[model samples]
Target: MSADDSSATARDSLDGGAATLTTRRLRYLGAALATLVALLHLLDPNHGLLELFALLYANPRVLVFDPRPAAFVVSATALLVGVSLSRNAPNRRPYYVAGIVVALTYVVGYLAWHLTGHGGFLPGREPLLHGVAPVANVVRHLTSDPWAAASMASELGLIATLVALLRRE
Candidate 1:
């Protein structure tokens, strides 16, 4: 092949490779952001659950009265993002696995807490009568006490996973 032709082919190949690498990096970044958000939720320290509840209230469409569904959505999204980004990255499987595990655990725990009536992570009393908004009333009664323990566990797990991802070679 002529030198010019060979050079052009090489440039095109280089450009394609660079584009692929950039896409992969962006995906990884998205995964990292999702993981960070989860970690923030786990680490938040609020004694009354008021702050947490307010935060949830802010996004009523997502959190509503029942947080399990919302949490599930967040966790599921995180898992998908983590998995997609880590597909070809080194030591990424473990991070992705950890993230998925944590997300699932959070959802399961939320559901269990609601079923048991042991009180939720947030604090408030369930309205006497179930009105049009059942989830809101349920969420109101969720005392922060339950969250203290659960949050501690979640915080530890998320921190460990975050560290692993950061240190992955």
Candidate 2:
């Protein structure tokens, strides 16, 4: 074979190798992200059970009612989606997209209340709920509450994974 043919073969092999590596990396990332989100919901100290229903959606006195069960459900679904993607299912792309959507929905929905004048979800932390100043709120959460810090970190992770999914071949 000519020298040019050998070089082309080498380039083709390298391209294939890179694609395989990227696929594996994305799958593992999706799984890990899903697991973290699930853990956060299940182990949340602030929004557990009664705290979620504390306001009782029916009560007119309440401006914000966080249903903890819903959070659990969403988290669990994300976990399942992650597991599916990790297995490299034929429909992995759809699952990844769904997971991103779920994460975005949860984050936006939770922050919406604070933006609409509910103040922070937790008492005495009104300043932390900087809906108008999202960047500041993230900084404060990282410095103040462990749960919020984890949440912020997870959001970053989810965003990263979403970008990867979008760019994947």
lDDT of 1: 0.51
lDDT of 2 by residue, 50-164 (tens): 4445544646244234344556555655666566654745445566677777777657755654454444554543544445476555445557888866765786687678668
RMSD of each: 14.1, 7.6
TM-score of each: 0.34, 0.64
lDDT of 1 by residue, 1-169 (tens): 5564465457657787674455455445546545554544534453123444666667755344455444544654565566566676544546555664665575456445544453334455253323424455446544435554454455445555545544332
| Model 1 per-residue lDDT at 136 | 53
- Model 2 compared with the native: what TM-score? 0.64
Q: By summed lDDT, which 10 consecutive residues of candidate 2 come out lowest?
A: 60-69
